[model samples]
Structure formats: C-alpha cells, structure tokens
Target: MHPGGIKTELGRHTDPVAEAQMIRTINQRNAAAGLPPFRYKTVPQGAATSVWAAVVADGDVVGRRYCEDCHVAQIAGDPEVRGGVQPYALDPDRADALWELSEAMVGERFDPLN
Candidate 1:
C-alpha cells in the first residue's frame, strides 16, 4: 500500500533539507495541476492496512495492492491524469517478470515466497 507520506524517519536518514525542498516543489506542481493537497500520517495509521491484511483480512485479499485502506483495491488511475497507474501495473506477466527479477537481483527467494 502507498502509505501516503507517513511520518517516517525517512527525512532524518536522507537529506532532510532536500526532501523538504522536493515536497514544496511537488506540492506546487500538484496545486497547479488542481490536485488535492497531500498530507502525512502517523506510523500507526500507515501500518493499519498492513496489519489488517496480515491479521484480519481473508486469504483472498492478501498479496494484493492497496492504497490506504485494508482489503481495498488501489484506485485505478486514468491514463489522462498525471502520476496515473500504467497498464503494466495491472499486468500479470509484468508482475511475474518483476518477481523473478527481484529474486534474482536479491540472490534469494524469500522463505514464504517459495
């Protein structure tokens, strides 16, 4: 799930100064494009969906992409919109290929994945 800018320690690890600048630039672009303002969430809020999928949701809903909500599909994006989901994002073949590539690159298939 895309956690939607959670209050992570990410800023501290990376160049916080640069990330702040980036946020401003991106917000300006989003505003100019008429998109809603982005916001941040606490760690618990960000972890809610993941925890739901792990502990509460049925097997059918596991391993699927979500946005912020548990057991919900990511909002399929329109091609006309900026930052929209691409066709490949929903392609089974592409996903399989990416999985194979990631395992190879990492030099191991994770225990549960096998």
Candidate 2:
C-alpha cells in the first residue's frame, strides 16, 4: 500500500523477465524523483499475491524496523539518524523522548533523524 492508500497486489509473477522489467521501471521512476531505488523490504503473507514493501529512504520518508506507523523525514546534519516522523515543531522534543526510550533498548546515540 502506498502512503496515499493505493494498494496493488502483484500476483505470482510467473514471468521472471516481466517482473524484472517492472522493477526496473519502478527504479527509474524513483531515480527520476531523486529517491532511493526500490528494494523489497518485507514480504507480506497472503494468497498467490506478491505483496511487497520497499525500503523507502528519502529526504521526506524514512524506513526503519521499529518506526513504521508514521512517515518520517531525514533531518539534515544528523547522518547517524535514519529519520523521524514528526513536524519541525515537535522534532527536538521527540528526539529527546526517543533518546530516553532507546536508553532501555540500545545504548547507541539517540539519532532521531538524519
């Protein structure tokens, strides 16, 4: 499902060559928009449908393991961070909160956005 809620169920692609072509098309579109190339991030279980999610890491979107509920964007000057999912007004505070929350998980720096 796309951020706009558009869903596409790519059923079993029996044609490997055709699947590759479709992927190439998607990659081209992403590249033209200055976004990262599309790659399978997760495989959703279902019928013969091919439900794929991409590792979306752009200036306006961040793809992470834990933070997947909301859309987060990369914050400049913080390369260590992947990105955050809040507006500028809530960034600093959210960062502090994430840092505190992460203290219990990983001891790494609380990088909210990159």
Candidate 3:
C-alpha cells in the first residue's frame, strides 16, 4: 500500500547533514510540478489501510495498491493530480526484484521469501 506520509518522527535517525539537502532537492522537484511539498498522515491513522490490506481484506485485494479509509484508489497517472496509485509500478516482476534485493540485504537476520 502507498501509505502516504505519516506524522511520526519516522526518519529522526537520518543524518541531519544530508536530510535538508535531500528534502530541498525533492521538494524542488515537487514545486516544479506545481504540487505542494510533502505532508503527512497521523501515525495512528497511517496504520488503518495497511491493517485492512493485511488482516481484513480478502485475497482478491492482493497485489493492489490501497490507501487510507479502505476504498479502491483513483489511479494517479499524472503527477499533477492529487492522491492515487500508480499501477504501472506495481507489477510482479518489480515485486520480485524488490524481494530479492531485500533478501540479499538481510537474509541472515530474517527469514526470506520463497
């Protein structure tokens, strides 16, 4: 699920020196597209959609991007548009690549996907 932004101090451990530079660069890109800089969801609210996808939603919901409040999202093909899923990026091949890379990074510390 594209959990959107969360209000937690999620990245507090990041290196302060690099954080501002990165945020500036990214927000500059967002500004170029006429979108506001990144904002966040509250930590408690952030978990709702994920919990729905993982525990409550049925198998038919698998492999689809979800958003908060648990409805099927509007697809966001154009960056100018507000919230929505970019379905082209969510295919199985990309997912497998992500899985393999994650397993390579932490296979010794955690159980890996089959």
Candidate 4:
C-alpha cells in the first residue's frame, strides 16, 4: 500500500523516497502475513510508465497491484491484456485463490504460468 496510491502519485513530481518507504511498509505487512513481498516494477496510467525496484527477498515477485481475476484471464486465453497496476478486490473466490498463492509463494519467486 503505497501511502499515496500508485495511480495517484506518479511521474516527474513523484517522490521516490516516500514511495520506497511505502513499499517497505507493504513488504513488512506481507512478510508478517507469510506472503511474498512485491517490488513494484512499473506503474502506467493511460500511457506513461514509471518503474520501482525493491530488494526482492528470497527472489520473490508478487502481484500486489494486479487484479487476480485479470491475472487469471491473462494466464488463460482471454485475449485481453488483463494485468494492471493496482490491487482489486473482486470476490471471495479470487481473494482466496490469491491468498493461497501468496502463501505458497512465501520466500519464493513468482513466475506467471502463461
């Protein structure tokens, strides 16, 4: 949870130090919950892109800011470029699946199976 939200604060006026702190907070929460720490790679709204890097503990990559449903769609053949730069709470099933996956991925890297 970036304090200012990824979409809300991006671009030249953005604050890297603040964003890093926010990412650290998110990582701490995830670690405490036995989940993977996601290092935000890029945030793009409309067309612009911004990259964020974090020290991935245990080589893990997380989908913290992506819709699990869309992530599933992207994994499947939905013909839609689904993954996005924000977290979404769609339903119980999706949420459960994400939690399970996150737990399974603790201290491990996440390579999308596509």
**In terms of TM-score, which candidate is strongest?**
1
Pairs with steric clashes in candidate 1: none
How would you encode candidate 2's per-residue C-alpha lDDT over 3-90 as one tens digit per residue?
A: 3212245545347798779778777766766666655533333211212224433523333322332333333333222223334434
Candidate 4 Cα lDDT to native: 0.44
Per-candidate count of clashing residue pairs (backbone under 3 Å): 0, 0, 0, 1
Model 3 scores worst on lDDT over the 10 consecutive residues at: 61-70
Which runs in model 1 stand beyond 4 Å of their true positions? 55-63, 78-86, 109-114
Can you write out model 4's per-residue Cα lDDT over 1-114, one digit (the tens) per residue?
122234544455768799678778777766766666754433452222212213221213333332231122123222122233322353557777886789688966566453
Ranking the candidates on lDDT from highest down gives 3, 1, 2, 4
RMSD of 3: 4.5
Per-residue lDDT tens digits for candidate 3, residues 1-114, read 656666457777878789777667667877877878866677767787788778887757544455545656776776544466676555778887777788788765455445
Report how far off residue 83 is in candidate 4 (Å).
Answer: 13
Residue pairs of candidate 3 with colliding backbone atoms: none
Local error of candidate 2 at residue 102 (angstroms): 47
lDDT of 1 by residue, 65-87 (tens): 54345555544454433354466
Select the stronger candidate by TM-score from 2 and 3: 3
Could you tell me the TM-score of candidate 2? 0.30
Report lDDT (CA) for all predictions: 0.66, 0.45, 0.68, 0.44
Sort all candidates by TM-score, best to worst. 1, 3, 4, 2
Steric clash count of candidate 4:
1
- Candidate 3 at residue 25, lDDT? 67
